[model samples]
Target chain A: MKCNAETIGLMHKYLDGDITTEEEQQLKYHLEDCEACQEHFRELKRTLTLIQSAERFEAPANFTANVMKNLPTEKKQVKYLRWFKMHPMLTAAAVFFILMFTGVFFTWEQDNQLVVSKQENLIIEGDTVIVPEGEVVEGDLLVKNGNLIINGTVDGNVTLVNGKLIDDDPLDNRGLMASVGEINGEFESVDQTFDWILYKLKGFAKKVFSFE
Target chain B: MEQIIREKIILVKKGDQSAYEDLVSFYQNKIYQHCYRMLGNAHEAEDIAQEAFIRAYVNIHSFDEKRKFSSWLYRIATNLSIDRLRKRKPDYFLDAEVKGTDGLDMYSQLQSEGASLVEEVENNELQRYIHTKISELPPKYRSIIILRYLEEFSLKEISEILDIPIGTVKTRIHRGREALRKRLRHV
Candidate 1:
């Protein structure tokens, strides 16, 4: 087998002993007869040796010290990280998500009984219960197979199916309260009742405090 | 269980300055040689070598006990040198590997020693040419050439350092060397 430019090109790595056993054999077989490739191989080897043996420069007297002087403070931080490591964003986001999750969970736990009672009332009433504005129902709700009219707010889902509702935005009913058939009326404004109650409570609180 | 090496590693990792110094002293020559060969400059090589040791000192925790420590150190030095080459490419090719002021045949002057000197000078020039041509090769091939020639690392050592298959290292080295030789032939 004759060695060509391609084979001779590989001769540098070959001479450096970087060639594979198979490649070594192939190169060896080719070089056994191919004088030009063999010569190229030897030259390449000599070059690698001369290059490796060439004089090397040493670092300046204070090279390491200089590097140390400019060393990043992150060295201390990497070790610190090994001991306790977490990304700031991930940590903050984790805290936020945990707080959010826990907030929902705790609220569900505290107000669960009220929600249950409202659900029971709806089931028991089993018919349209007209709730006047500013009226508060302190029991669970269950609107069974019937329409609920909201002249005011029922503290829970006002379910209706094939029933008429005489309010503006009727699609606000969604989420964990889906057991109710449907809802009627724009109850978004119904949230103001809390402010109204706080107003009355403030008056009562003021009257009570005034006596003190 | 190479107790001496094991103890040295343990001491260095424990932040023992003396142990670290001992390790530095032991490998400084080879490390400098690696950087010098890669960068074709003594001063830069020396700085890179020193920085490599410092890095080793800081990252000793990541070193696996079963592997050779010098190989790891050499890897860092080589990478640093290559990075320097990339940053200073235009200036690097112009450095002082050429002949004297007269630009007389440097090869002949080097060859006065003997016919062997011819190959030696040629090889030196060839390897020097490799420094410039190497940048043109793929990074993987470039790394193999640097490791094999500049660091004189064995195929197995390179495989260990790079965590690649030894066969792959062989192929890349072979291919990379061929590419270099071809490139030099044209020059």
Candidate 2:
């Protein structure tokens, strides 16, 4: 290629030892007869040399000390987090135990529900028991559960072990009954004549026990 | 040496204050010089250099060990200097022509040390003139020129430091050289 201003600029790169050998040879051949380009190259080289040789400024002696002094304090929380990162399994195990204990504490009451099968003749042990309808229970009834549903007829005295007794007929007592736990919820009956008595009993129970 | 610096950086990341100080000491001069050239003011350069070290320390955990710490430090210093420069003079446009005696004023602001007395008097003016010309270039072009010529960073390293593509770095270097050459020809 013939010498031109752009070629001379490229020659500046050549002078800086930045160009490929082929490009360097091409520029050298072009500059062999190009006096103006050579002069421009010379001036560019001189300017680049001046820039390259400029002295670097040194930081003040206390720069590092000053920077350290001004640094924000190392956060204790971050140090703890770094420690946790280094022992991931330990962190995970701690988290797991915390969650496990919380789960057990929160669900302790709800997990106390008991289901009594119709075929069993034994006393069910739980906080709540469901006694299905159309069964005849002959023995003294004792419900230790927090809630009791007795649709069957009882031949002996009915006793609420730790909770309220719920019957369809509140006044048709074949025997007397007693409760040791708070009574909750309304009792609905099939017989309409006892409804007023049930209402009066429920109102009395509400006033007497503050049942919710 | 690089491995030692990397180990120190890891220590800094782990909250070793002494290690952080060592890292700052290693880079303070180089970063201060880079900021001084970019900002054209010694006081601002020192402030920016300190700020860069502080920022690097604060965000050291985010630094990837695979990259060069010097390049990362340079990037922080360059960004801080540019931000300060932009804030100091809201009306100063990098692409605007060098007007009035602002160029000479900037030349006067250039400071050098450790040069022999003979060389200082003779070459100081010429050196300041060239540095002033460089300072006249836009921050973007000025940075590429400084990284390429002064800091002697490779184009790839410049790309990584500035977070730009290598092609853009090459283009900026070319345009910066052309602008400098045009200004020098006038002188």
Candidate that scores best on lDDT? 2
Q: Per-prediction TM-score, please?
A: 0.44, 0.56
Off by over 4 Å in 1: A1-35, A61-212, B87-143, B179-187
Local accuracy of candidate 2 as per-residue lDDT tens digits, B68-169: 999999999999988988898676554444333445433333323323435666757767777778888999999988998899998889999999998788
For candidate 1, the per-residue lDDT at B117 reads 41
> For candidate 1, what is the DockQ-based docking class?
incorrect
lDDT of each residue in A45-153, candidate 2, tens digit only: 6666666765567999999999999999986876777679789999999997688556544544343444333444444435555444545555455443355666544
> For model 1, how does the per-residue alpha-carbon lDDT over A88-203 read when each residue is reduced to its tens digit?
67767878768855664464345322122243222223344555444555433443233455444455443332233444236655452333333333232212334434533565
Q: Write the per-residue lDDT of candidate 1 for residues B32-137, one digit (tens) a residue.
A: 7667656654456666787788788788899997878888987787678768777874553433354224653435434453564466665565554555565567
lDDT of 2 at A62: 91
**lDDT to native, each model:** 0.59, 0.72
User: What interface RMSD does each of the candidate structures achieve?
Assistant: 5.8, 2.7
Candidate 1 chain A worst ten-residue window by lDDT:
A112-121
CA RMSD, predictions in order: 20.3, 15.9
Enumerate clash totals for all models, in the order shown. 11, 1
